[model samples]
Target: MSDILFTSSATAKNGRDGHVKSSDGMIDLDLVNPAENKEGKGSNPEQLFAAGYAACFDGALNLVASKKDKQIDSTTTAEVSFMKDKEDGGFKIGVTMNVEVQGVSPEDAEELVEAAHQFCPYSKATRGNIDVKLVPQAIE
Candidate 1:
């Protein structure tokens, strides 16, 4: 058996399964649910995807800004969208970034979006691997 200490656990019931505590126990997450969960009781994979995409985008953009010698406010965020492709027969996940950074130009923002697409963990995970659409838009 592994020596790691268990922090939390989740069971599938009422549409959601289990919960786990992060390092800072203030925020906890349910590890399982249906593909697209109905609101209120349980959370589905869409919410998880959105959460992961948002975090990944923010982190990736931070790295991009650091590489470009630019500073970004940690408050900046990205909105992720997951929509069904009726004709294509799959799902699409679109990411739009809303950033408020000083001294950053439109071009820089564009580059940062591209860089984030390359670096964001969720972006890579969804693109090609999954039948999902990924769109990252940069906004001020």
Candidate 2:
């Protein structure tokens, strides 16, 4: 696009009951449907999306805090749900990002999180396409 910073590629085969391997070979894993994965033998698309979003959001939060001259230690947990789309009779995804920030007041933590949502690339990409809820907490 506009001076690409990086690109990542992964290939998935056999749909939900298959294997996924990245171009760099760092993320080779088995794929399983969440509902059918009773034994939890493999990873699902939702799990991978959650992991990427959480890491990106947390980095965005720290960057925002640094710009405001505030130091914060934070962890972001992204809970992704796969559900039916009543509007289109298809499936959809939703995300809830629970962020805990230390070394800041609760109010400040909330503000930082809001700012991060605006800055995070993943949040921007999914802004109008999906539903995302942000919950921020301060660890005093």
Q: If scored against the real structure, what TM-score would every candidate get?
A: 0.57, 0.97
Estimate the TM-score for candidate 1: 0.57
Query: lDDT tens digits, residues 20-73, model 2?
Result: 999999999999897876876899899999999999999999999999999899
**Could you give the C-alpha RMSD of every candidate to the true structure, in order shown?**
6.0, 0.8
- Indicate which candidate wins on lDDT: 2
* Candidate lDDT values, in order: 0.60, 0.96
lDDT of 1 by residue, 26-80 (tens): 5456655454444536445456656666776778878888988887654345565
Question: What's the CA error at residue 55 for candidate 1, in Å?
Answer: 0.9
Q: After superposition, how far is residue 2 of candidate 1 from its true place, in Å?
A: 21
lDDT of 1: 0.60
- Clash pairs for candidate 1: 10-18, 10-19, 11-18
Cα RMSD (Å) between model 1 and the true structure?
Answer: 6.0
